[model samples]
Target: MSEKVISDYNGYDYKKEFWENVDREYEDQADRMAIRRLLPKRMEKFADIGGGYGRLANEYLKRARKVYIFDYSKTELAQAKEIYGDKIETKAGDIYKLPFKDNELDGLMMIRVTHHLKDMPKAIAELYRVLKPGGVAVIEVANKRTLPKMVRYVTFRSKVNPFSKEVANYKEISADGFYNYHPKYVEEIFNKTGFKRERVLSVSNFRSKTLKKVFKTNNLVKMEEAAQTALAPIRFAPSIYYKLRKPEK
Candidate 1:
């Protein structure tokens, strides 16, 4: 049986929303670059877990012989199929109980999706289950320890504990959302799941209303690249990218 978990995505019609907005383009690009950089060099096949609308999976075509869009969202999965045609394959299942056979994937990525998961360990174990011994996986974390949040806490204007190992609850303009994790917590889970951490990058560093208004998207992307290259050791961005590998048997 699939493990029971809490999530904010059960009935969300993502195709009718989110990506449709012109304003959210830069945010999309921010995550796109993170996944692109950490993608495996040689991939025979890979599954883009929780890949809605196939936005991130589309980018994997350059590396993978086949890219699979695996998600439980009917609307978004249909949209992905219509948009990409036969270029990508679609699979329907819960991430807790992946549909693929054991050792089926050479690479995998779960981007912009982990925040909604309430059971991170079980999900990570499932990811490890289907991946070949030598396969690579890239996952994203919605870092609660962002620089802005910490600065706000120091200035006495915020209630969020950026350093808390516990999941942080948040509210949004549309709905009350799920929780975000500290990067260290996610790192510990990956380590416990038998994955070797390959790399970590602090991306979406320029994710602020003021900064976005003052700069163009192209310029923001350039600066994001520079931050990722120079500040490789620190993870103070709102989004943290992790590259992991299953140990070679």
Candidate 2:
């Protein structure tokens, strides 16, 4: 049976009707970049840990022969089933104790999942376990080193006065709010876990919510391209992304 852990999103439904109906193209550019780093090889068997609502799985299904999703959120799994049909097979499971056999998957995609983990080592070990010899995996983090993120965290933890500091910009405790991560820490963990590091990709470059708002127009492709370049230099910096492969046994 799947473990009953606390909802990482603090009850926010990532698959709720409003979230699915809202114009996500404006905000999903970062997501697309994260997914692309995984680069699902055609006709391979893939597993998506923390595959919330199958958003990233939707992209994987287009390339892979078989795709399995493991998610703790039943609400997201329900939405995934409704939207993806049989293209995705979902298991209501936690990342800590994956249900699959060892060395079975060809690739793994952990999109937007790492920051929410209660235990990062256990989760990465499970990921390494299911992936077969020579299998690749993509991991994404919130990049705590980013200037924008630093300011936000500092302000949130400020003690002197609430009026003087900026108000907490992020209102909801989505999946990442519970357990936070930095890229260097992730790299060290992965290395200690025996997964060989490959490449890194950065998503949002600037910390300006104002700039994001200004660019959140109908022209999503243009906006993403601009953001991609802006964020390219720090793609390997903290709050970045990376590809890893399980060493061949």
- The C-alpha RMSD in Å for every predicted model, in order, reads 2.4, 5.6
lDDT of each: 0.83, 0.67
Residue-wise C-alpha lDDT for candidate 2, range 1-249, written one tens digit per residue: 233234453245776544466655544666675566457557478887888787766567877888888788877777788888888888887778898899989887887665565567777889899889898888776554556455554778633221222212121555333444555566788999999987766664533456657665445456555655466555423346678988887
**How many angstroms is residue 7 displaced in model 1 relative to the true structure, after the best TM-score fit?**
3.9
Scanning candidate 2 in windows of ten residues, the lowest lDDT window is 162-171
Candidate of highest TM-score: 1
Q: Estimated TM-score per prediction?
A: 0.91, 0.78
Q: Tens-digit lDDT track for model 1 on 37-155?
A: 89976799889999988877657977888889998887678888999999899998888899999899999999888777768888999999999999999998888888888998889
